[model samples]
Target: MALEINMNNFKEEVLEAKETVLADFWAPWCGPCRMQGPVLEKFAEANPDVKVVKINVDDNQELAMQFKIMSIPSMIVFKNGEAVNCAVGLQSKAALEELVK
Candidate 1:
């Protein structure tokens, strides 16, 4: 399972991390976000080198706004403390891998 992140730990878990980070911005009420969860878990299991985390928009409104997350199931790939790529929608395990690569 992907680690659940909030504003409190966002910097330590993602920004300061040495490895690539994949941050999934989502809300529990969103159907597509719910669907994306399992896929993200599978991706995390398959890709041990990458760090996978989930940010609940409802719980972390500040983070959601900071990232400009207008859509649920939005994915942002961070490397060296900077956002490198972004995707919005339900994503397959293969597609998730592609985002990190």
Candidate 2:
């Protein structure tokens, strides 16, 4: 399962995580976001070392604003508490692995 992150706890949960963190910024009503869901799940399963998180734009408005998430399916990967990679679209598991790697 994906850990939920929001502006209220983003700093503590994502920026302060000890390991790599992958944040999927999405919305429930978005078609593309729904399509990307399974891919994210697979990525999370394959990368247990990385903390995979989900930030719903509807539930976490502040986080979406903070991240400037204009897209429905955006992903930000953080390592050592800093964003190292970002993807803004539906992505394959292989593509995410390459970025995270």
Candidate 3:
């Protein structure tokens, strides 16, 4: 399972993380978010070095606004505390893997 991230732990777990962090912005009510979860789980299992974090947009509105998230299932790949890549909407595991690279 992806690490559940929020305002409290966002800095400690994501911003300061040594490994590349993949932050999935989602909400419980979102269908696309549901679809994206399993894909992330598989990816996380395969790639142990990469950190995967799930942020509930409803609970973390400030984070969503900070990242300019306009949709659920949006993914932001953070490298060295910076957002190097981003994908919005539902994406295949293969595509998401490629996005991490």
Q: In candidate 1, how many Å is residue 99 off?
A: 0.5
What TM-score against the true fold does each predicted structure earn?
0.98, 0.92, 0.98
- The runs of at least 3 residues in candidate 1 whose Cα sits more than 4 Å from the true structure, single-residue gaps closed, are none
**lDDT values for all models:** 0.95, 0.89, 0.95
Tens digit per residue, CA lDDT, model 2, 1-101: 89887777888889999988889999999999999888888898999998889999999888888888999799898988888999999999998888787
Off by over 4 Å in 3: none
> Which candidate model has the greater lDDT, 2 or 3?
3
Winner of 1 and 2 under TM-score: 1
Q: After superposition, how far is residue 42 of candidate 1 from its true place, in Å?
A: 0.7
RMSD to native for every prediction?
A: 0.6, 1.1, 0.5
